[model samples]
Target: MLPWIFIGLALFFGVFWFSGNAANILIIYVIGLTGMGVFLVLTSLTISKQSNLLKKAFETEKNYPPLLVKAILLFAGIGMLFGSIRYWQDVPFYQDQNFSVISGKPSSIDEYNSKGTVTELYVEIKGHTFVLDADMPQFPKYKKYEELLDKHFTILYLPNSNWIIDYKVE
Candidate 1:
């Protein structure tokens, strides 16, 4: 009975997290629910209790082990607290942001040999569309735009300090 209750609670929390605005919260909720569900199922099947009590808990009224509830609560509370903290610190999906253009123009064949080890991305944040600089210098190998990222590409510069480029589609 207790296992079922925990499972229901996990499902309820899971739904709320999925509907919320925070992506991190959704991730944590999924992990927490899955972990708790597994724990409850295992406990329901394994706890050595009097057959009569077990029957009463399951056949008549739903009841669960207090220790199990305590453990689940503790784990869930910690996860929720941590996730909330992270959500507060991260940038929301809706934000006005921009990306820096490193390459002056787009090139058919592009080469970025730079001194800075880049981790952050520069984007032109106008409303929702991210106008990637066609010619971004020192672009990251993994995240560069696909269209303007061939061995050879053309570089175009927008008068507004943004660069456009034509590179290999691959």
Candidate 2:
């Protein structure tokens, strides 16, 4: 019973740590690793405590159902591991993001993306190739943001990603 309480508290704290940064990939990865660590610790503690209990009480209590606990912990630990793997794959690229301002004409303009209202506009910046979200702050600066197919522009990208931090119509 005590061990199960400890395990529950650990899992709760793990979620509390992640709730604040649910949108942050790196934070999510850290939480996943931490949650798995907590699960392992609780499992070991439960095993040790079970051995120390008197025979009759141990037999009667059957306190924590081993199979049920194992299944729950295994499910949570595996879920966290998968999250960590996804974020881990991006770590190498994130470390070497280019910081220079780049310029080029978009080869294509994607209109009618349904992100918010059935297909918003997007511009594929030639140099970076990632479609910059047309609804971003810089959209108003473009005379007709969606008409970027042939126009040239300078774009600032967020480090290590295709996301445009800002843009200038040249």
Candidate 3:
């Protein structure tokens, strides 16, 4: 059960690292770090007094040494820190001043199909094209591709990735 909890935490962070918004990532990073710190401090204070209680609470036959728990926490903390740093590096590019705006109804909306499933959505507005994928931050906002057709939309996007940073239906 202890190992399963750690595995679930790892997978949660892995998915969040790829698809989470920059602001959300930062918030989670802070919260996760703070929670880990508090847990370590509390555990250190009570481990000797409640070692048996802790073992029984976990309901596992095997005991997890304090060192192993600390190691796992350290590893998770490092992974969150790395992901936060990487997301922060791209924050400046998503700022309002860095984004290019296009205001008009989309001329064409294309969905790329792979194995009978839509893998990518491409929207052409004015003369520029923007690509959206499930993993992208902006994909959820424009997910209903058919609704976007012939509807006037003001989109702010990064020029390099052509990923929408913001959009307004007008």
How far residue 25's Cα lies from its native spot in candidate 2, in Å, is: 12
The number of the candidate with the highest lDDT is 3
Residue-level error in angstroms, candidate 1, position 156? 22
Candidate 3 segments whose C-alpha is farther than 4 A from its true place: 1-91, 95-97, 114-119, 134-148
For model 3, name the residue pairs that clash: none
Report the error of model 2 at residue 82, Å.
8.2
Query: Tens-digit lDDT track for model 1 on 23-75?
Result: 32333444454544454445445444444455555554333554454456556
Q: What is the lDDT of residue 76 in candidate 2?
A: 68
The candidate scoring highest on TM-score is 2
Minimum summed lDDT over a 10-residue window in model 3 is located at 41-50
User: How would you encode candidate 3's per-residue C-alpha lDDT over 1-170 as one tens digit per residue?
Assistant: 34345445555554544444443344344345444443433334333432555566676545575445645555655555554454345456765357678889889888888998777777788889876554545454445578778578688775654546666665
Task: For residue 89, give model 1's deviation from the true position in Å.
Answer: 1.4
Better of 1 and 2 by TM-score: 2
Q: What local lDDT score does residue 70 receive in model 1, on the 0 to 100 scale? A: 47
Instruction: Provide the overall lDDT of each model, using Cα atoms, as 2-decimal numbers.
Output: 0.40, 0.55, 0.57
| Per-candidate clashes, comma-separated | 26, 5, 0
